[model samples]
Target: MKNYQLKRLSDQPILQTSDVKPSIDGFDVLGAFNPGACIVNNEVILLLRVAEAPGARPGFVKVPLLEEQNGVPTLIIKEFPEPEEDFDPRVVTIEGKAYLTSLSHLRLARSKDGIHFTVDEKPFLFPARMDESYGIEDARITFLDGKYWITYTAVSEHGPGVGLAVTTDFLDVERIGMILPPPNKDVALFPEKINGKYVLFHRPMVSDIGRPSIWLAESIDGEHWGNNRYLFGGRGANNPRFAWEGGKIGGGPEPMLTDEGWLLCYHGADETHAYSLALALLDKTDPTSILDRSDLPLLSPELPWEREGFFPNVVFSNGWVRWPEGSDKAGQIWVYYGAADDGVGLAELVQS
Candidate 1:
């Protein structure tokens, strides 16, 4: 089998921390990455995951938390004693618990050429529900049933849950609440129904017995998900040859229907927590049947920007757009990835 490779589009990141402004006055933009890509009205739309944190005070370490007040989510700040040494900017570890240094929200950006984008000043989707007290992140959009359905990770003290939302014109959005609750994320809906049922791919993190891996589920109404089947697990440290995914693996963008099968681009991390992208092909009818998979990464952190940032050595994605016919790059895949959890980068998936 020929190896799949991704052609990195630009030398610099497409969207960076500095390019995005914070939602709150005192907060600073930490990262703007992991966008969900789709085409609407002949334009490429990106729902960007924007991570922001407040400015550090003299002696106290402040963290932003969203709390529901009278059924409405409100942003609040909590202070903790500053750590003397080994201060990590991404997270604050106190006692045995951990708190994220920044809160993430989804913002919208549009590009006519799929390269340069005009970002929105405000957030498209933020922490509103109680389950999203920590943040809403890593959205995957699927245009099914005449509406744009979005599945994102809603995080809180409860853990990461899958939340659903729907939009018609991207102007007004309606929340469908949490579907798959806690210890689960990286959910992406299939663009079309299979065998008269809606299908989706999700990742459920395991703590005690098993490792975090990909799973497949089906739904009748697209809201209540069931009939789950274990799809596959990451090739962790046990596999010396494919140790790039030694940590965990999760679903990425919506599956693309191909002549060969259902092509899925997913993310995996090594023992060192270095994330990379890989491809898998599942049976078109029965998605549970895996046809083939990449033994090596299609995209890895090789460049300086991808190797060094808020979280180093990561090239994770939840979104990609197939260049439409009649366009300059028809039938090709344009992947939008998060570079080291700090900035957004673009790549062309040159299938081999």
Candidate 2:
């Protein structure tokens, strides 16, 4: 049965690489996608992952690096010999260390009707500290404790980890530092503490040894996390038997609280390596307990836009908003997701 109505589809990308200029430096914004969704002042707020790559040079491939010199913002251009290293447009691997083909920063975008978005021309956050030298990507926003909390993937030479930041107005951001260590991504927190403890979902990966699986954890004060429980992922050496999601899976946007249970929309890749959206129901009282899961994906790459660009056949979302009760569009969910890892798209799911 069809559940989602790609009803208000944006023919082109709502947010794309060409939408915004490069960060303070001369780096070009290669991709502006994977926005974490939230509603503030009756407007849709998206924390967008903005990836910037260096300008083209014939023999040298450049990677933008953010640094600080005497309290002044600086951009360090890291150049590599084009032929010596494996140079992909998205990744430059050198001496076994895989570095991003571009540096990423988070920018803000806003919308009133939840369809048309107005992205901020200027960058809101950039990589400067050593821990985030590689920059940040894929933020999951949660409103808790009187403020909006952001859990994003922090990349660096050390590895990819999860970091926390809080902002009440989306203007002044207070970073709480890394919450989950390296080899981890896809982190999101429930809006409220369950049974007096904060709950978080994360996908942790081990290099060449462990499988990438979603893990559930609890925190007392939202700072330190513990009591981890494996959630779900592909099994049996990359073929878990689940065809549409046999390759791998990761937690999507913040789970929505419903009368029936906690509704989770996650992304999974099958043997064909196509990324699609899957749904599941988790126990409200004990979120770790799975109640129901869809046998097949609810949304897959169907449109030409969804099947083309940075990562073809991919539809990934980190943000969403429930329609306001007073609005005419109540009882619906607006999912803002990245299409093919290059631009943003939206879909609305009517509640059952």
Candidate 3:
């Protein structure tokens, strides 16, 4: 558990400074949300999840900011005068009343140094009619063959699913539609095509067959995916109290392929929903085969900002960047994650 170390790069409130604010007519100018980062055109570009309030009752409909009216952003909030009798906590409900929450949309920001960022005036990607009725969340970007393939979470009343989008110039994005169906999320596509096919890691939730665990899938084309197989399962330590991760583990940023294997950074959560980061090595040829894995966490909730917020004790990542080799401080991966479902956080991972 102590072998791995997680250095804080950018802690909570990564976008909370006075300079950063939700667009006047945007959805999530104030709320802290998740983000995806990539090195593009010598600058770090971030696609952030913008969550906003719907002005409805606390338990009622949640809205998404897609358009502006009179220079003010508008939210499409669902109005439910009457709710159902039985409701599920995880699905979306506070009390007897049933209402929707604001869906996730994409906002654009750029940085020269990967630390300081300036947000774009207008949203880069808005919710489209295809499969994003509930909005998008946690985009994982992979640059391959001159195209940027983005895998993100598409949420709706049915369930949280995975969707695909592509961009060539970062400004124009073409929606590829939903690749993974409902009850699935936390998907990351490999940087390159594996055996002439695209490989991706995903998690499919099954309350009956097995616990929510990581799964692997491959596709000839990046859009259509198949050959789903179980990648990893939950691990319970003998001493329950000492186990930081027990419930589930999911693939985080794009896996870094090395001569030894594919270095994977993933997130694990305990029963209490406390999340931490872990590292694993998979066979370069067959990513489904595990080579090695860290028994302990590489990063965990330690700081006050990380330990407290909307959903406390969580550090979840969607993207990372590795420093180039041949330098004094090479072989380092910068992980950009969401903190407590509020703001974004960063961690530095040096080769061990």
- For all predictions, the C-alpha RMSD in Å is 1.4, 2.3, 4.4
Those runs of model 1 whose alpha carbons end farther than 4 Å from true positions after fitting are 1-3, 84-87, 95-97
**True-structure lDDT of candidate 3:** 0.73
Taking all chains together, the TM-score of candidate 1 against the true structure is: 0.96
lDDT value, candidate 2, whole model:
0.82
Q: Could you give candidate 3's per-residue lDDT for residues 1-352 as a string of tens digits? A: 2344678865445664233455534344434456777777667788887655445455454444334456554545545533456543223554533234555577787887677888875667766643566667888888887988888888765767998889988888998888899889988888888888988999997876667788889988777889999888667545565367677778888788877888878888987889988888899888888988877788888888788876789888888877666534356667888787777777787654
State the lDDT at 156 in candidate 1: 90
How many backbone clashes does every candidate have? 0, 1, 5
Model 1 Cα lDDT, one tens digit per residue, 1-352: 1456788989889888888878889899888999998999779999999998889888778888886778777889988988887777767878777788789999999999998899998999989878998899999999999999999999998889999999999989999999999989999999999999999999998887998889999999999999999999987658788788878999999999988889999998989999999999999999999999988888899999999998999999999999889888788889999999889999998856
Which pairs of residues collide in model 3? 22-29, 25-73, 32-342, 62-100, 62-101
The ten-residue window of minimal lDDT in model 1 covers 1-10
lDDT of each: 0.91, 0.82, 0.73
Model 3: residues with Cα > 4 Å off, grouped in runs:
1-4, 10-12, 17-20, 23-30, 56-75, 80-99, 237-242, 325-330
Error of 3 at 202 (Å): 0.8
Local accuracy of candidate 2 as per-residue lDDT tens digits, 12-120? 6677767777766666777888999999988889989988787888987777765667876476887877756345677777667777778888999888887777888
